[model samples]
Target: MDLEGLKLETERLLLRPVRGDDFESWAAFCADPETMHFLGGVQPRAIAWRAFLSTVGAWHVQGFSFFSVFERATGDWVGRVGPWQPEGWPGTEVGYSLARHAWGKGYATEAAATCIDWAVDTLGWTDIIQTIDPANTGSQAVARRLGASLRGPGRLPPPYENQPTQIWGQTREQWQVNRLRLRR
Candidate 1:
C-alpha cells in the first residue's frame, strides 16, 4: 500500500514521514551515545545519514517505516517510531527510538501504541514484535506498558546478528483486549 500520505497523530505527537530537514536532528540522535547504546552504538554523522535514508527507502520499498515523531506542543522532532521489518528480520515489528531528551515523558509508549494500532488495525497484521537489546530496560518497560509480553530470544538480520536481543510482543487479538482494558 502507498504510505506517502499517511500521518498518525496522538495527543502529544505527530507521526509522519521523515523529511530532509530532519537530518540534523536525526544525525544528532544517532550520535548520542546514551541514546544509541542499544541501537548499534553511536554512529558518525555520515553513518547516521545513511541510516536515515534507509528509513526513507523502507517507506518506498515496503510501504512502511518508522515515522518521524514531532512533539505537538513544541513542534520538535522527538524521535521515530512505527512498523519496521527488513529482509530476514525476526518478525513484523513495531519499533521505537527517541532522542535522549524525549525519554521519561511517555512519548515512546504513546507513539508506539499508535503505531501498533495502525499495524494491526490498518495494515492487518496478525502479530507485532519488538526486538530489544536485553540491556535496554527503558525500551523493555515501554514494550510492557504497551501490553507486550516477553516472547523469548531473537536475532537481528545480518551485520547485527551477533547482538543479544529479546523479542517482546503480542498477537492482534491480545492487543485488542489490552487496548480495551486501557480505555475502561
Candidate 2:
C-alpha cells in the first residue's frame, strides 16, 4: 500500500500512523482500566510498549494499522481508529479504540467513516467488519450511526479467541450509500 507518511484529517481530528513520540500517551491509554475494560484489561507499561511496537510494525509490514488520532483543536492524543485485519480476523475491519476522555463526541463515528472510505476506495475491500463485545453499547451505537448491521457473533485468534464478540458489518456499496448521509 506504500502508505508512507500517510495522514488523514476529519473535521475535528487528525489521524496518522503511530510515531515514536506516541508511545507514552498510547501506554497511558492502554493502562487506563476503565478504557481497557473491554479491551482485555489494562496492561502494564512493559506490555503496552510491546503493543506500541507491534502497532508501528504493522504499519510498515502490513502497510496499514489503526491511525493514532489527535484532537485538531488541542492536539491531544485521543485514540486509535482505522483499518485492521490480522491473521484469523473475520474480514477487513475498520476498528476503533479511543481514550475515555475522548468518548461521547462522535469521534469514533467520524474517524471510522473516514477510514471506511479509504478502505473501500483505496484498499479495494469489498466488505468491512467491527468485532465488538455485546455489552459495548457505545460501539454498537457508533456502528449503527455509521450504517452497519449486526452480522452475528464472532471470535478472534488465540489469546483473544475466547473473548465474546459480535460482528457488525456493511459492504463497499453500503458505505457509499452511507457516505451520502455524512455529506448531508
Candidate 3:
C-alpha cells in the first residue's frame, strides 16, 4: 500500500516507483526481443508503455503495485519487479521481469528476495504467488531459489495466448521460516 513512498534496496538493485520519464526505457525493455521472451516476444512501444501506465495507475487505486527496478551500480532501468494481483488470481502474487542482459547475474534473485522480505515483514502479505511461463526455466529457477514451492500449471485465457505457466508461492509463515534458516 502507498507505493509512492516505498523504496527497497537490495545488494545490486533499488526498487522505486515507476515515473513518467521512465516510459521510454521501460518501453524499450518491454519491446526488446530478448527481454520480451516471456511476454510473447515483444509488442509495439505504445502498447507496452500503455500497459506499464495501467499497472502504475492500478497501484494508485489499489494501494499496492509493482516498482521499477534499477541497477544501483550503473543506475540503469533494469526493468520491473513487484507484487501483482490480477482479477482472477487468488492472492497477491509476486511478479518480476528484467532486461535480457541482466539475466544470469543473480539480480533477479537478490531483488526478489528483498521484495518478498518487505512483503511479509512490512506489508503484511500472506500468500505470495508467481506464475512463470513454463518455457522460461530461468524465471522458474529464480522462483524456486526464492523459496516458493511449485503449485502446478496455470492458463491465462484469451488475448494472452502465452504458454502455460507454472505457479509457485510462499506463505508468510514459509517466508519467515526461510528467513530464520538463513539467519542461522
Candidate 4:
C-alpha cells in the first residue's frame, strides 16, 4: 500500500503517519510520568527518539502503524492511536496513548474505534485485541466504550514479561454489531 497521502480524519481529529516534527510532542508525552504511567515508564529524551523511530519504522516494516493524532480544531498534537502488534504479541491489537491534557475528552475511544475499523477493513484483521493494564481504569473505560470485552489475562514479549495486562477484544462480526450502536 502506498501510504504516502493516506490519512484518516474524524470530525475533530486528523490521523496520519508519524512525522519528524511530531517527535518533539511525542517525546514530551513519553517523558511525562503521568502520561507514561501505564505505557511502560517515563523515557528520557534519547530513549524517546528511538521509541519514535520504532513507530515510524513499523509503518515501513508492517505496512501500517499507529496514527499520530491531532485535534483538528487547534492543530495540537494529542497523541497516537491505531494498529500495533510486535513479534510476540498475543493478537492483532489496536491501542491508544494520549497526552494528559488530551484525557477526559473521549479522544481515546474515538481514535481507537476509528483504528479498529481501519484495521479490520484495510488490514483484513479477523479479530482485534487491546492489552490494557488492569489498574488503568481510564483505558478500560475506553475499551468498554468501544464494545470490547475483557477476554482474559495477556502477556507481552520479553523485556515487558513481568508487566500485567488484561486482553480485551471482539471479532469483526461483533464489531459490526457494536459499531452500529455508536453514534456517528
Provide the global lDDT of candidate 1 against the true structure.
Answer: 0.92
For 1-184, candidate 4 gives per-residue lDDT tens digits of: 6676988988899899898999999999999999999999999999999989999999999988889999999999999999999899999999999999999999998888889999999999999989999999999999999999999999999888899999999999999888889765
- Number of the top-ranking candidate, with lDDT as the measure: 4
Writing each residue's lDDT as its tens digit, candidate 2 over 1-184 gives 5455688998899999888999989999999999999889999999999988988888889888889999999999999999998888988999999999999999999899999988888779999899999999999999999999999999899899999999999988998998899868
Alpha carbon lDDT of each predicted model:
0.92, 0.91, 0.79, 0.92
lDDT of 1 by residue, 1-184 (tens): 5456778999889999887888999999998999999999999998999999999998888778899999999999999999999989989999999999999999999999899899998889999999999988999999988899999999898899999999999999999987776555
Best by TM-score: 4
Assess candidate 4 and give its lDDT: 0.92
What's the distance in Å from true for residue 66, model 2? 0.7
lDDT of 3 by residue, 27-78 (tens): 8887788888787778798788778887878678775667888889999988
List clashing residue pairs in candidate 1.
none
Off by over 4 Å in 2: 1-4
Candidates, ranked, lDDT:
4, 1, 2, 3
RMSD of each: 1.2, 1.1, 2.0, 0.8
